[model samples]
Target: MNKPMFGIDFGTTNTRIAFYDGETVELVKIRNPDSGVDVANIPTQAGFDEKNGNWHFGFDAEGFKQPKDSMKWMLLRDYPVEEISGTESKELVTLFFHHLKAVVAEARADEYEGQELSHAVLSIPVTFSLEERRALCESVEAAGIVVEQIYYEPVSALYAALRENFRQMPIDENLSGRIAVFDWGGGTLDIAIATIRNGFLYILKRDTLLRGGKDFDQIIVEKAMQDLKSKYNRHLDSYIETAYHQKAADLKKTAERIKISLQNRDNFALNYPRFIPKGAVNPPVEEDINLNFPVLKENLRNWIGKDIEQGIELLKECICQTGIPLDDIGLATRCIILAGGTSNLSLIEERLLEEFGTLKFGPLEKIERVPPIETYSSEPRRFFSSDKFGREDDASVATAVGNALLAADGGIPTFTCDIGLIVLSPTGQPYPKRIFQEGSPLPIDKPIIRQLPIINRGQEVISIQIYFQSIGYIKGEFEIHVDVKEHTVEISFHVDRYRILRVSGTGKNYPKRTQQSQDAIMDFPIAFRLPEKLKT
Candidate 1:
């Protein structure tokens, strides 16, 4: 039997997996081993148990009393060691994949029928650097799963939306029109502007912010702390300091619950016992907190309103960067599609509708004062009824769904390099060379070759420095020694599907003296950077 392919969306807060089984794409439900209770998604948490020198992941790590760290967004960036819960980032990521693989095996035991998990398409953030992408691939590979392709989360979400809404709209018009995907998930907010042409998704511009639902939860926590101080005239920071883990965890959970509840109802009153340090207060304090709807809305707006405006501005900037007229953007854009968990927030929808004019809420009819798509084509009406993925008010899994769809579609995942490559002279000064121009499609099958002629005799070493125009730094340097018989050195550069650059070459020798043979290879994993024109 052929191995089943899977799509894994590794998210900051939750991870979702999906697979296509010839008929339809279905999400895998991971059941807790002990409880046998199926969970919609697995929490992205892991811990290193020092006592056993073992690693725990997901729900297993939750049982550990020791400090557990979430290395979702932190793993993608250069984070300080002290901030990472005293565990190595790479180890935590590997542990996460190890547990994830076990869950997938159990969830799809019947479908796999004793076959090992072979192929998978992984979804990553648009802003992921090349190093981060390579790290993710290595971690997955270490867990015994083969990563077939790496896809952008927003692009995957767009694919899912296209599948859900394609038949209802005019194919030609929708394909030609601009589509903006606003993905506001747990850890980050990403906005991508693109158009579909000839059945291919063409991304024109994309922007990402390190802000999302978690930020809103933090805002609520801060407000709750302020409220407690105002009501009882006692700061809870001291109490939190006494039991940092438990108290902070309780506060964050309470805040998140209240925030989600506020979506359906106007207000919610949360009554819970306040944490009091022993001997700090004579009497125990019980807190009664009444969270008002208007206050929550106002606070949310205050916290993220500028972020929404920035997203809109980024969309405009992208259009400009693509050389499209401002007036034409409105006519070309079909609708602003919102995805991810944070997209459910009413405040986000209101802000997006105000800025973008036409917003697609995806079955969120309870959004007060917002208009829905009134008219529909004579296609299958059931498909347009709700969030077509069978999930209610949850667009968080859209990336996983779309990734599965794309994996089934069977195409090579492609990306464009934003920076142009240049080589430097022996004087240490950089000289521009368009080895690969900016906005060039990657996984270039053809290798770019450059030959350097030996200028001086007795030159022991020849140094060549490479620089990326967009990043404004030396990518790396290659050193070649000059033999008395060598005349010219040829360097060849090739980029693979994973954005890993390979450099190899041979040296040409002068006639008369026995030709000095040279064979060397250098590998560089290129990082992603914003386009030079787009950088501010």
Candidate 2:
């Protein structure tokens, strides 16, 4: 009980931390005051030189020409790591914690005056695999922070989200009702839809995509390079290639400002010489910088409009997939909770308003179109930066902080293993059986019994194959060896996120098992509502 608990939220672009002062959670955005990370815009870009094994980070790191390693970005939640490589191997909970420690120590000496770090809670994405979740726990342990708990990113965002933004809006469950999550951020564009459940908190039902606002920024950066090449009219194919690094950085900065402005204004006036986030200086000639003053709200909208519309449609498709009626959701929908950095876009809000916009805007046809602006609306949609959190960093840091909360709960711990044995052919031959699946949830163990009708003193020992699902069918028997003793046999399977699984067994004389019984055999980590294909 004497343990001091703190919340650490490490976001993609920024990091925000807080401590539960035995009461209210205070913002602890302090970096390692002694380290370069203490300065804003520095930690995410830090790099390590392998040759000399040197560490480099901070604002300067952001401006580097080489591909730098991001310590903070290493803790990405919701990844299906089985498909990843490199740092992916470090996805273990222990390894993740190690990275956190470096970040903390960097910040502590820089921010907390080198105080001893203690307990912490963390957050992660809504649908991380059990293994990924386990890795999150490992990160906390690696950080040496006594983990208190772990929670879903969205769930934690809900806990500390800025509420004033969408607390009063009309909500709907049927995606057709159109609640757009225009999440356009640095790494991913995570979009989801909301349906009012009963005038209460907006209950989300479907996701659109993971792409974020950063993609658009990246898109514009590409355009800028192309335009620069066109202007220089270089004969070399690598034309403007050398300028790409600094120019792209400059473009992203301009894009952010333009992006921010497009929400509420008709146009974004790009000044000739803008300061880039990475500190690449670009003093463009008036013609070169070309005041694309009004990237015309419509022009910018058209650029990313398809993505927004697809996002909306994705929600609709998911809602329809849920098999719920549109009216059922609309009428029963309650309040909506819009939490995320990209949700702040005006184009998104304006497009959304056309669908759910109040009569205060007047006339459905005039204010709303079928695809509502079947195109991009003008720039400058009214924005409400949810007042739920006081600090500016609160919005961006909430998800990361929420992930820390998850770490503290001991909620993300488990071992995994694969069970031995397999399904057999009818002729007393062995069929390898797998019992556990990778990334399966916690404390999930299962039992399967097959009775083989045997005559008295039937000497034929029944061999029961225990195995797990593979690309389609059950995988081969475990690489280990086991013996059969009876014709009537029973098998059990067990598993967790960490150990994967451990398979051992006692069995009865089992043979001539029915196809039906074989089909219903349960899998370890048995709790999931498995897909039909995996149910077997």
Candidate 3:
């Protein structure tokens, strides 16, 4: 019998995994072996135990006295970490996946006893580059699970939403509309504009911000510190500050809890022991931090409100770029899909509704209510109809569930490229040319070939370097010794579903370019260009 396939949403704040057992799709619950607490999502956190010199993950790592290292979106960027090495980050991610595999094994022990969990479909943010995707696949593969395919996060959510809400809407042979997915999570906020034509989702534009719920938490923490200083007329001692800095993981958890608790309530109290020092006292003092909804709301608006406005503006730009009229957008667009844990905040929904004016899912008053995590299910019908629209936790794991569904159904129709492809000129200077523009459909079966003439007579070798306009690094290059008689060389580029670039070159005199072709497999890099777009 074939092994069951799993879908994983490796999110910034939390990670979720679901399995497809031929007939039914179920969200796997990962329980902390030490705490015995069943959690639908695991925190994407890891730490090194000082005493044992061993690495821990998820809840175990979060509970450590020392600060936990979070690799969240680090894989997407080339930023070097002073403390944690790249290998360590990969190992941590691998350990987390190993834990997920164990959980799935334990859950299916009865029906598929002693069966090894293998194949999986992973979901990534729309803005993830080819390099980031490859790094993620490598990490998961290191954990012993074979990654079968990768789906974009918003695309997966769209699939789940369409599957569940299909019965509620009109079933037409030609169903076409736009869906603006506002996915704001812990470490990143990605606003994507996609169109559904003939039952397939195509991304028109995607704008990403390297800011999200974590930024909100930081704002809250800073605000709380300021408030405490003003109220108590006391500052945190250097020692206390150092200690709290070391416990960033715990402090962040506290801030996040307060933020969530204040979602529905008017006020929430954030209390911490030994938070500040009382005038030369050897021992630090505790603080009872009370933050009202209005004050918290105002603070959020004052700090991150500009970012929210920018997000909405980007949405409008996407609509404009897609040639969708502003007035018709409300009707032409099926719904404004909100996914990711940060979307739970009423402010985000309010801002979007204020701008767009039409949300297919429902109104703010109707969809803002937070549902208990236990109410979540992997079944499509039960998943959407369990509540009026859907559960609050749905935003957290919808991507994972949808990925499992796509994997089971042999995946969906969605493009992968996000930036224009370019190559270096023969003059040794980097000259940009668009081989394939962003938002193009994936699995390009036909190769894009370009012919370069050997103008320099008696040149021993001809070298071709490929580069992506967005990604600064050289993707791949090949060199062929000049056959004095040959006039031109043919360079062909083929990008697969996984965004892996396959470049091959053939000379008229040299029929055997197989070895050179094998050496041209390189993951293309995507450039960071949101700020550049905003500036323009």
Candidate 4:
């Protein structure tokens, strides 16, 4: 058999993996040893045990009896060690990946007993910075896995949705048109607008909203705590910020469960015994507190309504950024595909239907012959599908499944963030001067050349600082040992398919002393991330 290649969707709240061959894709299911039931994904969480000095992950971490070490979204930050103690965030992230690998190995021992699960295609958010991307690669490598490629989250989902829903139609036949992907996951809502032609997916615009299903869960948790205090006249705040104890862990778990149940039901009763043990809070509690919080779907909608509205606004902004006229877009759009777990919400689906027209699922419904479009037709029609993939919770696995197909056929990934250099203004303030814009295909063909005036002719060293979106900057210096007669240095920047930047510099004109051009090349492995404040 060919060497097994896995596709990993390393999400903020949950992680999933899949194996794909040239013809088919198989999601690698994890059989819980404790429950003896199979699950499609694991939570992106970790815990450090102080007593045994051992680390636990996923379900194990959630069930750890000791005080819970909250290490959920630390991987998203450049310097993630601020709140964490006992070990650095990188170590914990690596350990989580290691545990993930071990679990997969144990679950699939029958098929992949001797084969090494070394290679993988990983998916990441567009907001990841250069440092964050490097850290992720290092952690994955430390966990004994090599990253074959990194794909943007929304793009992978779009690709998967397109292929899965439109499998019968040839690309050139009826698949070419404008497409939008609304990927609402646990931690982020990613929207992408692209045009497909001749089987190639070209991303025209993309945006991210820094809120998602997790935020809804948090809102419910806070409300539940407030209700507990109101009815019992006792504070149930578990002091999660300073002391992440078992009570806080259990409370969060209960809140998450409540959120899931309320998705399909009209209401849910959150009952937990001993929610807060005696003396767990300040102004010492006299006795244990039990929570019996009654929640309604209307209450949930009211709580998260503004957040959901903001998400719709973001989608509008993404469509506008595509530079396509609304009328033309409505005419040309093939489908507005939905991916990620949050897309399963009825509220979101209803909002999409109200915003657009009625949506129709092409794969499920029989395709009938229709009249060809007239170029000047002005009638508004539905562009997005009402539902996707005809499965209960398929949105959760769309990205991983798409990534698995990409690993098999080798999908082309676009550069998701801006890459630029830090230039000084007349006031001596530094700012980014972008050379490579986002939404372009990877491995830029042409090099960007710039000429800089030599500040100090006496020093033969030239220093340059490159900025990656809003993340931070990295500095590189090139020394050209030549005559100082030439007052300017020429620098060229080229990015390869691996996202490695090759920067070369040389004296513009040869000095009469040597009459030779000296060149210095510096290779920097670079990746990009986006800013939290969406650009207007």
* Separate clash counts for every candidate: 0, 112, 1, 1
- List the candidates ranked by lDDT, beginning with the highest: 4, 3, 1, 2
Per-model TM-score versus the true fold: 0.74, 0.58, 0.74, 0.74
lDDT of 4: 0.62
Q: Clashes in model 4: which pairs?
A: 128-529
Model 2 residue runs over 4 Å out of place are 1-4, 8-10, 31-43, 48-53, 58-60, 65-119, 126-140, 145-150, 161-185, 191-208, 234-237, 246-254, 261-297, 358-391, 401-482, 486-536
Candidate 2: deviation at residue 461, Å? 11
lDDT of 2 by residue, 219-319 (tens): 66665555545654644225245445535544565676677677678876554353222232243234323323336678778888887787656644545
Q: For candidate 1, what is the TM-score?
A: 0.74
Candidate 4 C-alpha error for residue 130, in Å = 2.1
C-alpha lDDT (0 to 100) for residue 99 of candidate 3:
77
Write down the RMSD of all candidates, one decimal each. Answer: 7.8, 10.7, 8.3, 8.6
Off by over 4 Å in 4: 1-4, 32-35, 65-72, 76-84, 109-114, 173-176, 233-246, 278-287, 326-329, 359-393, 413-482, 485-502, 508-536
Whole-model lDDT, model 2: 0.43
In candidate 3 the C-alpha lDDT for residue 269 amounts to 61
Q: After superposition, how far is residue 191 of candidate 3 from its true place, in Å?
A: 2.2
TM-score of 4: 0.74
lDDT of 4 by residue, 154-189 (tens): 877876765554454434322445577888888888
In lDDT terms, which candidate is top?
Answer: 4
202-224 per-residue lDDT for model 3 (tens digits): 56677777777888877777676
- Candidate 1 residues 4-28, lDDT tens each? 4688888876788877664456667
Backbone clash tally for model 1? 0
